[model samples]
Target: MSHARRSVLVPSVMAFGFAFLYVPILAMIGYSFNNSRLVTVWDSANSPTLKWYSALWRNQQVLDAAWLSFRIALLNATGAAILGTLAGLVLARFGRFRGRTLFTALTTAPLVMPEVITGLSLLLLFVAMEQTIGWPAGRGVTTLTIAHITFSLSYVAVIVQSRLAGFDLSLEEAAMDLGARPVTVFLRITLPLIAPAIVSGWLLAFTLSWDDLVISQFVAGPGSSTLPMVIFSKVRLGVTPDINALATLMVLTVAVGVVIATVLLRRQERRRERDLRLAAGAD
Candidate 1:
């Protein structure tokens, strides 16, 4: 093909692929405005209503479930971010001695393991622990958070490792050579440089924790139902209009956050490029 034709073909194909992928999401969003609770049917030819959105506010069960999900996600993501970043730093940078590979393997094993298996294993472990230690008392938010942390850590670790792999370490070396203490060098140079990766990892972990249903279902108990678990139950009863409204809201929030993040990242890249160009011109 001619170069012009190839360029057009590539962009056309990409546009088609993206539209195909997003059409369902767009349709779901549209359906959330349907006046009919039956869904899957047109609300009216002329209008869409925000009644479902208003109704969502009144849904105490959903509100509580969402609050619970948020709490768990924050706890799991924060804990996973710190713990996994430490592990990732060690494994990717300072790792030494035998069993290092084994530890690494175990850390990432959950990424490939079936969720059902992980859920079952964790449930069994929790049960065994309660029986043996009598400390946990019962499965609840704490147990669910623990389970989320276990699964989310792998994602956080891998993200941090990727960031560290390409990082320029001379900054830290220079800081240390300038008489700065080890902790000072780490705080000033290393942490700031890796902050983006850490934030990205935390967001990813939070997303995974929030989206999880199978694991949460196994570990969650009374008054500990997560948003996804509630969604799961609603889906089983057939997708209600209210559920569609909730899903639509979630989709919008996620889409907006992703778009904003992408824009910020691109803007940062452009700023860096401009700075480099200016520096080069000055030299």
Candidate 2:
């Protein structure tokens, strides 16, 4: 293709892609403010009202589900980050330990495994554990959190492993050479270098947990519904404006989080670069 034609084609395609992706989200946000009972039908005379937002606020069921999902997501993210970091550290740094291949495969099996299979297996395991040891009593928030953590940790491990693959080991070596213990070197030098990856992994795990439905459905018992579950049920009944408001609020929260994470990562990158320049100048 000619350069002029290619440029126009590229921009046109890009615009189309962006619109295709975001137009629905824009529509949802717009519909959240709609005054009509039917979400799609715009009531222009009484449009742009906060009625749905107010109704969503007063919805005890949604509030309970959101709180439950938030708590589970938070726990899942923290647990997944810690476990995944350890697993990644072992894979990246252990260097040909006994059963390394098996360990690595088992750790990453979830990435390729079907969610249905994973959920079913977890359900069976939980049932067996409960029957055998009389522990957990029954499925609830605890089971839901554990299930989320199990699947989410694999994602975090993959992210941490990828980050470590391109990382410099010289810093840790220098710390060790300076009489720092292995633990100290890891805590002081290795952790800081990998902090960005850990944060990214945590956020990804949180999102996964928050949005999970299939696994949560398998593991959750009575009165343990998550926000996704609630939304799914409500959508089956009909798409209401309250649901739209809820979704818009979720989108806003995610957007704000992404912005904050981007700013923090950029600042950290700048600080690291500045430090490197200063060290080079001193040397």
Candidate 3:
């Protein structure tokens, strides 16, 4: 196919896919206002009501779980971003050190490990720790965050390391030649270049922590519930229109975040391009 035709075809196909994916979500949101308990019906006469949302406001269980989820997500994501970026920098730049390959391999192993296995293993470890040390009385938010950080660190490390590999180290060398200290050069030059990678890693870690079910289920104890766990239990019991309401809110939140991130990335790319053009002109 011609390039023009391919472009059109690709967008058309993508548009169809997006529509297919999101239309159901839109319908779910519409159904949240549904006065009837049934999800399938769209009866306009008795259809529209904000009762579910109102009820959701008063739901202490859900509100508490969501608060805990957000807090854990932030902690896990931030911790993973810091530790992972440092590790990634060491691996990518330091190079060929003893046990480097072994550590790298071990770090990435979690990516392929089954969720059930990871969850079960963590659960067992927690149990053993409590038995031996008599601490962490039971699995809870702290334990859950630790599990999420374990996996998130691997993701963040891989992302930042990949970014560093393609980055221009000449900037650092140039700063040093101009009489800047190594630390000063790194703080002013290297950090900004890798900021995008760090942000992306943090976002991924946050989403993973928030959406995790299996590991949270295994590690969470009495009263320490995440949103996904609550939703899973609800689904297993039976379907409720309330679930659709909850799903609708989650979809909106995620969509807004993704859109904002994409816009910021595009803006950054444009700024970089403009700066490059200006530098070339100056020379």
Q: Give the TM-score of candidate 1.
A: 0.90
lDDT of 1 by residue, 1-283 (tens): 4687669889999999999999988888898888887787785963499889999999999999999999999999999999889878877677496888888898899898999999999999999999999957898988999999999998888888888887767767788889999889878877766677788889889999989999999999887899999899989978788888899999889888878877886787578669879997999
Cα lDDT of model 2 by residue, 193-215, tens digit: 78999999999999999999989
lDDT by residue (tens digit), candidate 3, 72-124: 99999999999888878886777688999898887789888999999999989
Q: How do the predictions measure up, each by TM-score?
A: 0.90, 0.95, 0.89
Which of the numbered candidates is closest to the native, going by highest lDDT?
Answer: 2
Cα deviation at 256, candidate 2, in Å, is 1.2
lDDT of 3: 0.87
For residue 91, model 1's alpha carbon misses the true position, in angstroms, by: 2.8
Winner on lDDT between 2 and 3 is 2
How many residue pairs clash per model?
A: 0, 0, 0
